[model samples]
Target: MKNVVLRASSMTQSGKYLLRSIQNESMPKIDLLIRECLQNSLDAAVSRNKGEKVFVDIQVGSCETKKINALFDGLTKELNKRFTSVTVDYISLRDSNTVGLTGPLKEEDIKEEGNYGNLRKLVYDFGQPQVEENSGGSWGIGKTVCYRIGIGIVIYYSKIKLAGNKFESRLAAMLIEDETSPKSLLRSAGLKNGNTSKGIAWWGNEDINGSSYPITDEDEIAAILKDLQIQAYTADETGTTIIIPYIDQQALEINANPYGTLQGKLKDYIGLAVQRWYFPRLYNKEYEFGAYLEFTINGYKIRGTKIRPYFQEMQKLYNITTKAILNDNQNVEKPSDIYIAAIDMNSTFSDGRTAGFVAYKKYNEAELSMLPPNNEPQPYTLLLRDDDDDDTGNMPVIAYCRQAGMVINYEINSAWTHGLPKLTEGEFLLGFFQPNGKKRLRKPDGMSGIEITLDEYLRSTERADHSNWEDKEVYGKKQRIIEKIQKNLPKKIAATYEESAEERKAKADQSLQRNLGKAFLPPSGFGKAAPVRPKTPGKPPATPVFKTHNLSFKLEDMSFSDNGSVCVPFSMTVKNGLDNIHLYLKAHTSQQEIDPGTWEKDIGSNFPAVVLYENLELYLGKVAYTSVEPVYSSKHVCYGIHISQLDSCYNAKGKITLQGKLYFKHNDPTISIRVVAEEGDR
Candidate 1:
């Protein structure tokens, strides 16, 4: 058989670029692996029948060491050390429901664009540029992750549905062990060579024309796979399954990802990594930018079951995108909330990518509804990270993706952060940027924001993350886009937006004070003398409603009076003391004697306060003056609290209690006094 030893120079250069070169931190090596392989799969994916998402299976299984018997005559002596310690453990990542690798096995001698020669290119070439728009890996360095995963070795197997109803299968392997030493014998699985360097090992017989193809005989192929201790593709499957053998536990350990670790095992870590990286595609219910689903890691589906626990959090993020964060049209009906804008721009000044994209939804800290902490409290926070403070979830950088739904980068670097708007008052932002794949997506004419044609010029560094783009134009454009969003979205979101962390705390405290809760008071000790009636029974006792404030009250406000004798609006809370009783302030004096300063109600200038509590609303409670003349009082102040809207007092069994305050409008000074209780012991 003719030997096909690849040029040593080309091999060395590719190996250096992919494995030997330390471009960035090694912890993300696996992430790079996941990103690239999956990107390729999705690019070649097709709906099962008409409209269905693609399915991927990332499996971890083992084989017996004796099974892999591929050997060379003189090479065995030199390769013994290399092959001796290799565990039969392997990770078989396969993607089904896709258009199987359907292309010529080899590139034609004459160069052409649509050569359909993927199998040959993937098996033989390195750093080959992909002409497809939605294709990933601008530098093709991502494929080197396979070599990095193991001791520099990778295998490929594909099952293709050819013309008519026929099917075809092929297999290839790449080995990148350093060849600097004389004893080192690095070889790949390819054509069997009795002459020259052992290069290609064909699963099938060579054609009459000397062209190699996979062994079509299922029995032969199966036996060969079993012999080599390699995973086999399913007969009915019509896609690709990659086997990363000699699983490198040491490699994974040496990387030591302190942040994103999963159990200590590489296999376990892989599962978590998959969920973290590909969650968006799996949770794509909108079916707009991404259509990936049914992800399984080590046989566990990442959708509703294995990843079910994270769904609530993922949904919190997903809902923001599907339902806009700021879209508020009634008829044509925009999404619930979103800040839309054109993302397209110039390539001359920016990174050289053609600008185009649609639909960007902001998850500005508040919109995420309170993410969980990444540290530990049962469920993890978003992306399983509690960076920054380590107790709270970090605001993720906007996840930017190509049109094919393949994530290019998560904008997590300083370069990206420097360009983004600074979060104020604990306000951060996360926007999902979905660039249109060379399509012009127009915003609805009735929509409030401008059209979104985002120009995403990701002139990325070797890290594959566009973290270090110094292009003034690209940064300038992106900054301008963010500035515009900041200027517009808040105004619209202010209408129905969820309260920020600080606001939530204030509102909750306010509600707690105003709403009377069930009393949990300690049992009173038995007393020998039980008074039939206390002295001065008609007089209401003066007791502070809450420790925080002492409020002056009319005795009539405490009693169930049919006449309009009292109007008191106040918030009271109690702790430390268990006086589990509900009491009201009564007017100790007559209505005329208890007269308050009267002022004309003017809403625009100085209107009555609108005291809003969760359970009750004392419209006039916020006003400085208790009584306002007819023409002066705002409707709120005139109405006062409805019978249903009186302030309720509650106290917990603790050393904390709250008191109320009565403010005079003209002087604006508060009158501090204990609330007068009704006749009851309460």
Candidate 2:
């Protein structure tokens, strides 16, 4: 055995791929970035407030060409005592504490206060980057994308400090410019002096230059901070006031004409993106955040209103959350649960994605007759929501996508140039995010909206996560939602076409007769006949003439006892009745009127007297048993003829003459006729 120990190589593995930071200018737009920032602030406020009641004031005006200001404040307090204890070695500590932050951070530590970093500096600055050491910080590079766009940011931090018997308050503001090496500048504007205001003095001396302009009153700053902290009780006074003096170059690029148009568009785009990811900042009561972003041209402030998908419009387009159950286990009291959230919209704007409607339909229908033949499958549209109000937009159209359990977070890329999906003529953009957390986009085809295949979606999900059975659950839920949607599709479509109740009822009745006739009533020894009747006397006489298909018959009436045994008062006449008609009749001497929407067992038959005489006759006129189809279509043949007193059956090879009018008992349920007869010959 070799006794020499294995020696490690002096030179380590090399050639590790170094990812170059893409220039932020290549990003889509600042609108999306600003929106995301504003969202972060709002989320911070909501989390602190315990509800979504934070007020966001956006100012889009300019002291120069144009400026945007966002103020987020709801629940806030003074900085914790720990911040005061934070060591500021300024030399070796700066290098060790510097790297790159995973998320947004205060500027005082990132750059020298009151300094600047232009585009070149941002790219070439050798100064070490400051990284977020806070456990609550986000993944790196997300917010950097915003800063790289050259959009200025100012953050004001206010926190409560708890010291022995005495509380202190403090405010810190740091502003950054869009340059190679951004500078963190502190505004000397809003400052206050109180007994033992050591933290305030220290922060100011380190970050801001003392100034006397703009009413430099320390007492006023303290009062403002005190009042701004909602439900905050601190032994000392503390708060923050952020001010941004510079705007993003891309934001400046947007056209400022049409006051609300630019702002509205940008807001919409940005608002959607913010709605996607989680907002954890709003959960802390120690901080209340909001934004007041304004867009202006020259110096005039521009006004804009938010846009949202109206609930009323949504009601028109699609249904609310739908539920379904799968019958996998018969013994289980609770079947498998499935849920699908889909919004249907008008077909015209579907492709444009201007309307937030989704195309939700069943995947298994052989022929979805409820949908117009021209109609195709489309994906569910994305809806825009404002945590504040609805009716924020005119055009209700917007785009949406879903795959399995995952759906597109419109709030992530609303303002990104490439993020906005395109709409085509007769073709809507469909996006689906599956439970397996995958995304799929589909284009509309023909009159039908875009159709996302369930099989394909499920298959993709299975491939993505083999171990996650929950993916299958998601697919099941989506399928259930689709089924629920399909169940109500006919009614929804009918509502659009404005189909009448009578028409609907008639069609339904016909359908029922065709599909479920055997279940309701089986075929007796009767021939086919159109269920029509000729008006006659309300009650049958003792003996009357029975008129049938071109034939007549007179029969003697024999009166017997009651109890539905035998009652033939006199002779009966069968007129217009065809020859060779086999007839069996029962006479009811009672008189009554049937009420609507009511049915009774043994109710009088609903057949005509003439056709009823045919009894078990299968052939009428020259038409044999096999020729029944042609005779019925020709309209030259008749079936059963039910009289006033009873029903009569008839069938014949040729025309036959009959007798006088027949009578029937009014409101009788037991009398029915089964017969076949001919009406007219060529």
Candidate 3:
């Protein structure tokens, strides 16, 4: 066995550049590493072996530097120069009950239409498309996450059973670094022969052509595994093992205070990450196609029985979604505390069969405290955290995924969850969305009308990291399936939380007088006692010329703007004849009413910048001087329009209608504006 460092060539990607391909700031680098590795492992599970559970084991430990220094030929001197330690920390991941990288060993043997195999795809290729249908990976760049968490040195070992019951084990290693760096190990190794370094090196058996191939000698593989202190797969076992050497333990524990020790914190994080991304498939037995996932970290098994306190709510939500899909979403019983709804997400580009389901639940502090205590935090806190404000409390979160059962994203304060109601103190809302993978869809015209599953459709919308679903344009037109989902999801959730039967009855009774069109109104004395008049009658008061028959306002929509401001759109109606109307707005809070003029003094922000009325933009703190124009005063927070002015402006005599939006600098959704309409000037 020998080490092979490629010579720099045109358009070649440096190791440092490749390592940064999967950088996700929202999640910790350690968590990202775990997620990507497990996703690939789950995707490689053997499908033919029914009822066989797929198990993944992650071992974190250290090995003496001198013990395995000889494994890397050209990079040994550089390793010793960089790390000043007797032992090197490492992380190993092994998966059982799976197919272990079965494919042609040589690059020239690959074919366009034939199976590229997992071995070549993972070890040699970059950014290749996933050949498997409904697979978790799409861009194939997720493998770079391995290099991100370590010193860019990773070893791969896999054992596959051939057709004749013979077993073959393949072992290889790769080291990546910024070859251009003045302190680069590859540069220090002098492997480039005075030429620029490609920043990549591979270790394996050298063939006659000077090309490196995986070491297939079982004896050699066993010796190396023992030296690295990695648990080897048995002779009869078939799976893959990944070892990343020289890991930064402190880097993995950044910002995490779950445990007192580094190892404890690492273990807690690994377990939480596994449950966060794979809870849907963990111990699930509902779907025959869904593989059960078992996870272990440093010899500690993460089983459903012990981790229930951390993920019980999410598990329940997953069950609700799967059951709805299994029953064809027809007449399925839902839990009283949970609200489940399904939406037909089919569009013009679809085959008229695609659908997505959402389930929502609210938990109070009391209910949350019932879970058993543990060193790690609950999944809700991890899933529903507001990225912008740490102390803003838990916000409404919607965890969404495709049929693969791995969560694609936890959406908070995004367009996908724009209309969800704000959570009050002491409670939070959790929601889950899954597209029906079984539903088939066909592309629109100019694209050959090719059929694809809903799962495939959703996968097309994911970026390389598979973190969020985005809108993609096809044939120069927007697909808009995601748009439709976003637009309809909150409406469905709101409908599920509709008023109770008794509440509806009471509302009906209160509105019955108005619903009867004012014809069946009761007389003043019809059902009451007689009135008492004053002894001396005074001069009757003069009646006003203008009277408002009906005045009402309704909030149409409320949402957060791009700059973290609150936007409110409302509509107001003014019935009957009127000479003038004055609209006063006050900041309404639970404590007191604050006039718009003093909004800045009370709430530390200015009033709405402007109130929009159709094409007329009325700037607050200004006033109108003409019939078609409007203005305001800095001291008085009033918007007044004369009926005679409206008559001359638009020829609408004695009638006025207003609909516009108010843009406030404040972001608190709980704060509202109260509107009071009066006759003439106040």
Candidate 4:
């Protein structure tokens, strides 16, 4: 049989635009490629069989361009014209023990339901709806990540068992590039005329009508696979293999250099990236419904036993959540080390079901030290940039996913952390949330409601990248459900660790009394009524100095700055004081005041930036005083503002008000202000 040639339909899409459309800013391109490809493979798990594990192999290597240059028709010309290279590095992802792209081989054969099947959806289609329920992909745009990671050329091969125990193999190739480029594959193939070419071309069996279809001849596929130096699937094997030629090796090695002595290879990064996003699925045996994912890179398997230690705590939390769902019990008791709190979406959204549960565990220095350490860097550190060696003051981290078990995101700070208590020194919090996929809800409609599963509700909140859940007004009243979930996450987590009401009130009272005594109370005999004495014969009785008993400082408003810092507007009133008043600003948690010096030392950053009041700025450990106005300076304990003597009689009847804005850096913890006032020298 003659080799297939490249073909492009009339008025198709530009490859460059398609690649850019699905670009994810939050994740690196290589990570995105791995995550999306793996997700698709999992979604295509064979439905006829149960208890079968899906096997995925990610192989990276280089091959001479001339060996397989003839397979892609005009691809060789474009490659030679664009890049100066003898060999092209490629990444091949193959999966078996699952269903391959099963669908119509031609576009006109699509069903009335607009079902393009896995083959068309992955290779030719864009933004198609997912046919299977509870599928991991919703946006239908994930496949573009493959094109973006390479030179916009990808080969597709799949082997599937047909009726009568017969086996069939499919092979095709696609090249997407900037059509505007003079050396574009579309132009070289003579498919471009002015703006007609979408910068996309495909290589396959060309029909009389010029439409391309996947080549079904096993001999042709084997010849091409042999030339490319990729292993061909056996006759009995079933699954898909995606080959991305001319991969940008440097793009895959972007953050690999940070890992000391790892040689910054693609395999090292690929292993960690797999564990970072897919740990929940790796070697998971508790849940029968969840797919068991097996991964390998360069023929070396990523063993679950070896990588489990790094994510043992999180994995345990995931298992607990999974077990709760499996047992049909949402109210799971908190264990000694972990707290499993059920997020009751029914309470807020009136859905009559729990959205999910958040599993939280605080690891102190001693607890973290007891865990086994791996010489290789932790996956979270490489992916999240969080240093695990420094166990103190690690911000409360939470990773959330859906029923698919692919982590949607790992967030250190977000709306889920708001109103949550701050972690103490030498401690950090880790949590994971998975929505109740089995539960169902009714989305609001005109005079009626559309029933949907909680998984679908949450999936709607995710964008194309599936990084974070956001509330879009298009979801209608369902948006309120998303909002409630975000608002309730911290509340539920706090409920698990918060102190009793009486204990809280007592603590609050102590903090209030301490701050009041230091900031409001005057010294002995300064504000008290003095005893009268007879005037001396040669001297007049001295005039009594009035004490300021009505000094008030209140926080008027607080907001977030553009850079995520905190801005506080405050008002201070002085009534009937002729003495200099020293004011101190402190960042206070529920328990006690945070010492600026101690905070800077522990947190690895300055406690907070200087508090600006008009033309004066107050920092830590420094004091600046104006002749007739207030003195401002940063102190070791707190920021200080010193005000000189004020007119006692003039401002006695009317309150003299001072208002200013206090600015704090973005990294500063959530805290209330503690203002202290003391009498200073005249």
Candidate 5:
């Protein structure tokens, strides 16, 4: 224990360092712990067919320190010593039906190039490389997590099942601190080995030189546990249980959740963190042993039926995931069990051409209302590889991954805005780009999951994204992966935002004003069968009223709108009650509506005394409207006789209102010289 350090000069520094190593963009330290722990269990299960049923249990206990006996005085190396008593908390993790830590008892037993047992893989080494394909953690740092749980005091007891009906038990303690002299090594634990290993301690009576090896003898194991008043391993079971003698007091205070009537304890929040991040691996068909989780702190417990309510609360995510898998990422499609999206992204060095469906899930606003408080939409873009358990809820709004399913970087949804259409507030997008695992079948979606796959990337972080979600830098040789994704994925998803023709029309012209009344002003009455401008031009611009042969007409007022509607006010008096009066409007240039012609003989018989054309009968008192709803004065219209009732029009160009044509409903609906409005007797 000379060069090596075990105990921290500061607990906060040690705790923070351990936390930072396991933390992810989307999860808290506790969540990262749960995910890493259960995933390790799953990887262990995959080692055997029957071990697939992985049920992991967690127990948190708070107890006051009992007088620790047998402490060796630094100078004399004698036992029969005591230490100060303090209230300590502990958490234990027990996984059933697992191949417990059964392997080399010491570093000497390990080989240069061969298989090792969990015991050595965990205790004897720090940062030991894992041999399993699906196993997690970077450099075996995860194994030390238990030791970092409290004031750095953790003991491991494993009951291993051997061949036939045999079983062996192993007990060891691991502690780390500042290096000390051989005679006075406070950071030391486990077998003394006469002067050999000082890190791991085993059960057995001390030998001549004060060194003790593991007590493999079954009777000895039982007698030792019985003597210490500790629980003995059951005869029929085999698994590993980790014990933390002292938990971090500051960690509890810092991570405790303040939400409900009862302030959530640190351990209770950790239990919730487990539920948030590990549910993906734990959810099952209820009866089956897919994955089991349990957490307890003090009097409170997150075990058995208690997890149901928490689990059920995440049902909204299932619905979203269901859409991605079965309905082609749309709610309208008939749901199918499988969904696939092919991705094809290629940088000069790396190629990402894989077919898979993008999976996305988030707690929507409606779902958040159902939960009591604190809990909100937990959005996670599930790419292939995500190694974390911290449920602190800091996540990349959009996660970018590679073919192996490892998320290289967790990115924010806004990061894509530079290359795509702008997104509105309250709108979120999460996509899971997964490569097909089975027969390399062609899929369009999963093809381009990775952007920059530089050969020299992350020599230290085990291909994990080291930067937090908000950190943005042009990565790789020349902004390779990030640039490539921005060049394509945004354009594709943006196309889905297009609107239909009917939808456009409904939104643009829902009001009557937009649907302007249509009127066609065709020509008539010419020597060439064209319009005839009658010789009825009387008064000049200075005169307000003009007299025709039969009646008096006055140009009251005229108005035109930028939106193509026109309004005109005209007054006509024919002495007695005027005959049928109607307003005709047509949309024309500043010029004319019809060509006029003179009265000709037989050759130009097409010219009539009057000609006929298409004209609309306007509703009384209504002119073109400025607003959606027409506002009119009842007193504005001539008595009894109707003038016009015009709301806003939808015509490309609103119809033009002609000079007031006063005409009685004769045999035809054309302008008649006799009924034309003329000046009154005044």
Candidate 6:
């Protein structure tokens, strides 16, 4: 029978091909894989700590040549034991409903439908492949997904325990046959095991397809594992540890240029991933077992959990509690209230208080009877652990009632999905037994109970910031909650008549009359001509004012956007001897003077000469004004002056060029002055 079974297995190569596919297929993203593993670690710790929160701390740094390090600490030891070593040849980030071993590559099928990529080699590893019973990757294929990403091999699970005890540690690696192949890319540059002390433990090296062996340094190995200590959760007993000598190539690249890539990608979760996952380890001050778990990433402690003040505030605001039933019959009794702490998903990294809540009520002796059933004649429901209970060991971490029981399944991803693109489909409904608290919410078979979906009810709570949260549509029943919330918002400010189309047109018309130039407008463009201050009557100085010229303002072209904002253009010019000042419709005042130069005399509309400068854009602070104010400045003489603001004028004197239009009305019309000043005018 044994010979027949072996022969039958050898007859077909499908299993071999499948294993090869796992070793050579497109590797799952590295960071995402780490995130999943880290998430699992946190889940385990929090569960074991009696609902104590967890957190993830990440440290990024450089290592030996071509190496980058990601030190994960908080609650890291258990993760090490659970996943002592993670290879890249195979992995699956998403869960599934179907049976059979699903490939990580299979997940990409959800969008690509199998056209993505495939694995080739059967990358081997020694680590606990199953995160939980009946979970995918239980056969150890998941760790291989990391192997394909240039992580030459994994030499982890050597020796690590939670309580500093010994356990089964697996160490493994692969021999690369090709440089171009993603699955078997070698880390060593053709250096065999015998050539270096680091590879002394391995068997004699063999040269195959230019591939070589790379050994992990003992010091480097210890350093990384030490950093993971802060993330571990352990008792006075045993535990586990897993180590991968190298991270994925992409992760290394991201670490190389953190500012340009990795930092930006993990900006939100980088600080919290480790912390949230290993919350209990971070906050557990009661563990006196002397470092039950030690996790270090490059020798840095991944802090535990941070108690958010906002959540504390929310607890104060509402007396939170969950109401549940014991059985499926209408006569089933009701359970006590459960207080829940808020866990805000949308809040900023610094705002730990933005999350929703976890509810729990005080537990009692007879409460087990009142609690939802766990087996037949009942359904599995959310289990609320009593912190005050003494008889229930940590094993009660998972409550097992008679027939039906409760399960608190947190959907962290929902935080990312909700309000992104659009509002959640409906109001979050949270009901233990809402319509009637005493009615039995569990089913007879004890599968899924009739408990209310909390998400639907709680989501009904209105968003505080409509512009921020309700900027889009709310589907189905949620529309009513949105409408109800909308009523409470402050009314929009009333629009003013000055902002009306008619008023804007009148303003434009008025501006047109002013910018058309003296040739086009009448006395509006003509400014009073002041006598040029003559040089000392007799003595002739080195410089002299050979000529003086005066120019007038003019109007030009105008345009506006749909919003009614206007843009005007004009021109002006002035000539004195060889110096000729020509001002295009657009004149910058700040270039010629420190401040705005105004006309010494006022214009028709009580408006002062304007101060205009390039890049001096001010929509509300300073209105966009257009006028032709040209000035000519030369050594021998100065002439033709146009001043916008008083600050730009030298004793109310500046030469203006008689070239462009200057007819736009100065709304203030306060300080513009026209003066004739020449060189040597003293």
- TM-score pick, better of 3 and 6: 3
Q: Estimate each model's TM-score.
A: 0.56, 0.28, 0.71, 0.70, 0.51, 0.30
How would you order the candidates by TM-score, starting with the best?
Answer: 3, 4, 1, 5, 6, 2
lDDT of 1 at 287: 43
What are the per-residue Cα lDDT tens digits for candidate 5 across 175-241?
A: 4422233532343333233333333233233344443334466665565444333455687677776
The 0-to-1 C-alpha lDDT of every candidate, in the order given, reads: 0.43, 0.25, 0.66, 0.66, 0.39, 0.26
What is the model-wide C-alpha lDDT for candidate 4? Answer: 0.66
Those runs of model 2 whose alpha carbons end farther than 4 Å from true positions after fitting are: 1-28, 42-52, 63-137, 145-170, 173-204, 207-242, 248-306, 310-682
Q: What is model 3's C-alpha RMSD?
A: 12.2
By how many angstroms RMSD does model 6 differ from the true structure? 21.7
Which whole-number lDDT from 0 to 100 does residue 427 have in model 4?
Answer: 53
Query: Which residue pairs come into collision in candidate 3?
Result: 622-631, 622-632, 623-631, 623-632, 624-630, 624-631
Could you give candidate 2's per-residue lDDT for residues 210-319 as a string of tens digits? 22112123454454333333122233333222233234423534521112222334434334322222121212122112222222222232222121222112221222
* lDDT string, candidate 1, 334-359, tens digits: 35554433343432222323232223
User: How does model 4 score by TM-score?
Assistant: 0.70
Off by over 4 Å in 5: 1-29, 46-51, 67-87, 178-232, 256-263, 285-340, 346-352, 361-363, 369-396, 399-495, 498-682
Clashing pairs in 4: 14-198, 519-677, 619-634, 620-634, 621-634, 621-635, 622-634
Scanning candidate 4 in windows of ten residues, the lowest lDDT window is 516-525
